[model samples]
Target: MKLTVLGYLGGYPSHGGGTSSYLLESNGFKLLIDFGSGALLSLEKVTDPLTIDAMILTHYHNDHIADVGVMQYYWQLHAERPKEAVLPIYGHREDIQHFDSLEWSGATQKVAYKPEEKLNLGPYQITFMKTHHPVTAYALRILEIKTGKILVFTADSAYFDGLIDICQDADLLITDTNFFANKVGQKWHMTTFETGRLASQANVKRLLLSHLPEIADQDRLVQETIQALNKPIQVQTAKTRLAIEI
Candidate 1:
């Protein structure tokens, strides 16, 4: 399986390097993890969002779902004719409602699925678990049934103790890390320290820190996380075009 980091930040309007979306593909099958406010622009730097096979959302924050309307426009204008355009969308029920309420005009016609239950998209089998957030949210686990490669994506949420159930033995775990150790224990979002500790405890093979707070330095934050972790797992800061094969 091939995984591409299309974007890897939370609050973007980023003046620097970090972006806010992620794309995963294997055997011609494309799956998008999150499409933040700037993701469409960032996505254009990598691949055409109009051609993606499916999209999954972990939450409904503006930074996360802001591109849905734009994506619909892309497919409607730039892509092939009507019969050739189809994309599957999976998200928490509330997320579905929020997007639906946007009444994105022609966009509603493209809904393939609303994640009524555990479902399959392209090469991946998916399972959505609840997460702690102001809005109802989900932590997504995608496993390639044929290869048994598993990847987990946590959208935006505070560190919850029961996270192990969603992340055990994952090949790659992409988590939200929006603060430092001293600033953890907030009502929302996780710090680098908390993420490293959870990844270590989950025993996932690899950890990718993402969704940095606007004030955090990417290099320093990751370095601190690496030192605090002190584990054998592969840990790295996520970036654009960075690909992981599982």
Candidate 2:
């Protein structure tokens, strides 16, 4: 299994950065998690848009779904091959209009998912857990069926005990750490301290700190995260890719 960090900027992007997005590949199948702002441009650098098998939207937040419409149009722009099939996009029902916008290009199929739901796609078995965010966001627990290796993505959320259990024994934890340690109780997001704490408690094999807001200092965050853990962690952004043999 291989996972590429396409973009990790939070609500807004920095001069040359972008919001949350990741490319996960397992058993020759490609899947995109969140099409945040600037994600389309970053995605082109890693692989052909035409090759993506599916996309999952964790929520309707602008930073997370900004490129959803554009992704659909990317298909129609290729006139030679005449890509007719709609891309399968999984999202929540609360944001139907955002998903529907893809229909304008006639190149997307919307698949709604409920919080705490479970489903299978290719070689991955995925479970979605409701998160503590103002809007409906979900944390994902994905298991690679062939190897029993698991990955948990804490889409965007405040700290909660459920997250610990949901992420238990994950091979990797890709978490959203948008705020500083001072903002611990906020409802919409999590702090760097909480991000590291959750990973430590869950005992995940590896932790990838992401969803970083541009204003925060990366070095400081990494230092603080390290102070909170006994294991190794990586501060990742676009093009930072990791391959795991499960």
Candidate 3:
């Protein structure tokens, strides 16, 4: 299984960075995790947008789904598109308005996903866990069926005890580190301290700090996490086009 960081900045694009987005691939199948601001442009640098097999959204935030409409437009007007081709966008139905907008004419299909059910898409088996955010969001655990490699995405959430179990033994844990270690008592996103603690307690093999804050020093976030962990582990900050194999 291979994972690529398309965009990693938390809320908005700055310093030539985009918001949260990722691409996961296995056995020639491409799965897009989010389509945040500047994501489509970044994605075009790697692969054709029409080639994406499916997209799963964690929530309806603009930073997370900003380019979704443009993506539909791209498929609708692209001359090279197959006549029967249609993109499947997987999302929760908690926000009916946003969920309904996922379907765009015949260009895309909206597929609802329940947190309780497991999803089988291409070469992966996925499970969802609801996150503690203002809006309904879900963290995803994706397992490569053939390789048994696990990848967990924390999506957007605050620190919670359930996250440890959800990320347990994951080969890669991509966490939402949207705040510094000093920022505490927040309910929307995790801090570097919480991210480090989760990765350590969950025993993840490798850690990728994503959904990053735009103003903070990126290296310091990594260093703080390492200090909080107090252990040797392969840790890295997410950057556009950074690819890893698991």
Candidate 4:
């Protein structure tokens, strides 16, 4: 399984970056995890937008789904689009208005994913866990069926005990590290220290700090996470176009 960082900055994009978006591929099947601000332009640098097999969203937050409208426009008007192409956009049904927007004419289809059920899409088997966020966001655990590799993404959340179990033994854990270590008692996103604690307790092989703060010194965020870790583990900050194989 291969994972590519299309965009990683949290909240609003800055410094030529975009907010939370990733591409996961296995056996030529491309699965787009989110379509945040600036994501379409970044995605074009790697592959054709029309080539994306499917898309999934963790919640309806603007930073997470900002480019979804533009993506629909691309599928609707792109000259090279296939005649019968319809992209399946998987999203939770908690927000009916945003979920309805997932479908755009014949270009896209809205598919509701229940947190209680497991979903099989192409080469991956996915399970969802509701996250501790202001909105009804979900964390995803994707398992590559053929390779037995697991990739977990904590879309957006505050630290919660359940997360440790959901993320346990993952080959890669992409966490929502939207705040620095000093910021605490917030409910929207995880801090650098909290992220490191989760990764260490879960015993994930590798940790990728994503959904990053735009203005903070990114290197310091990584260093803080490393210092907070209970044991040694591979840690890296998410950057556009950064690709990793699991």
Q: If scored against the real structure, what TM-score would every candidate get? A: 0.89, 0.90, 0.98, 0.98
The ten-residue window of minimal lDDT in model 4 covers: 179-188
Q: Is candidate 1 or candidate 3 better by lDDT?
A: 3
lDDT of 2 by residue, 11-110 (tens): 8767877888888899789999998888898888889888888898888898888888788778767665445766788887776676565454457788
Weakest 10 consecutive residues of candidate 1 by summed lDDT: 107-116
lDDT of each: 0.75, 0.79, 0.93, 0.93
Give the alpha carbon lDDT tens digit for every residue of 76-186 in model 1.
Answer: 676354654556666555555675643444443424334446677788888877788888778888898889999988778899888878888899998888787788344
Candidate 3 lDDT over residue span 76-148, tens digit each:
9997898899999999999999999999987999999988999999999999999999999999999999999
After superposition, candidate 3 runs with Cα above 4 Å error: none
How high a TM-score does candidate 1 get?
0.89
**lDDT of the structure predicted as candidate 1:** 0.75
Model 2, which residues run further than 4 Å from truth? 82-84, 102-105, 184-187, 230-246
**Once superposed on the true structure, which residue ranges of model 4 sit more than 4 Å away at CA?**
none
- lDDT order of candidates, top first: 4, 3, 2, 1
Give model 4's TM-score versus the native structure.
Answer: 0.98
- Total backbone collisions, model 3: 0
lDDT of 2: 0.79
